[model samples]
Target: MKHINREVGSLLTRIIEKREKFLRAGDHKDDLLGLLLKSNLNEVEVNKNSDGGMSMADVIEECKLFYFAGQETTANLLTWTMIVLSMHNEWQERAREEVLQVFGNNKPDYDDLNRF
Candidate 1:
């Protein structure tokens, strides 16, 4: 567990570092990390005389929480969807048809997923 935690922490640190670089370069994104960094930057600016903003560790922790939470949510959604589809053949067929129609043997992209 400690090893896994260390690995995840290292990955998050690298991601944060890259995002910070982009932020400093004025190429800001509107994603969660970007927003958090922007907010932290603003807070630091506002409280230049004091330590008022989140540290790099704090940002990494927030990202970790969001990352795990999103994974859990997606897992739960897929599990329940499978269970329901197993119980309802009609709905399952409809869903399969929709997927085929939307994807057509190709990997589904974000925009195509929305249509599905």
Candidate 2:
């Protein structure tokens, strides 16, 4: 258990370091991490828990949780979608057409996500 915790701690450290490096490099993208870092709150301010903000540690843990949960959910979704599509190629083609209509070979944005 201690080894596992140590490994997780190391992973979080690496993630934080990489994010800090990116910030130092001025590679600011408009994402969740960008928004959080832009807030310019210290770990102490975040830990105050007064405005639904999170500490650095909490952000790291949330990122780890989101990564694992999103991975599992996406895998399951693709698996089931493939199984169903194999049984219904027509529906699969229709689905593809609809997606093409919605996205037009471009990346979907937040507004597009809500259309579904």
Candidate 3:
């Protein structure tokens, strides 16, 4: 697990490094770190739990988890998709056509995913 974790970490770092290279070329942000940050919830509602509001620290940790989980899942899905397509070229073509038809605008909505 450690070896596999290290390999994944290394690859992710490389991916981010490459993305940063493009930004260095011309991109700039008012808050570079802010651009990398996101919250899973817009706001915390008041509950019986004290003053009620997602603590900033908790928000940050959750964001890290969300980012890592999303990245890893996406990576695995793409890898498997490629392997499956290679092993079944006929099915691959059909899948491509369906995807194109549903998301012909190049943007897929939640509804489109359900069709899959």
Evaluated against the true structure, the overall lDDT of model 1 is 0.91
Candidate 3 TM-score over all chains jointly: 0.41
Clashing pairs in 3: none
Clashing pairs in 2: none
Taking every candidate in turn, the Cα RMSD to the unseen true structure, in Å, is 2.4, 7.2, 11.4
lDDT of 1 at 14: 93
Candidate 1 backbone collisions, by pair: none
- Kindly give the stretch of ten consecutive residues in candidate 3 with the minimal lDDT sum: 37-46
Candidate 2 residue-wise lDDT, 41-103, digit = tens: 444356675655565677777777877898999999999999999999999999999999888
Model number with the top lDDT: 1
TM-score of candidate 2 relative to the true fold: 0.53
Clashes of each: 0, 0, 0
The local lDDT score (0 to 100) that residue 38 gets in candidate 1 is 89
Ranking by TM-score: 1, 2, 3
Give the per-residue Cα lDDT of candidate 3 at 85.
Answer: 96
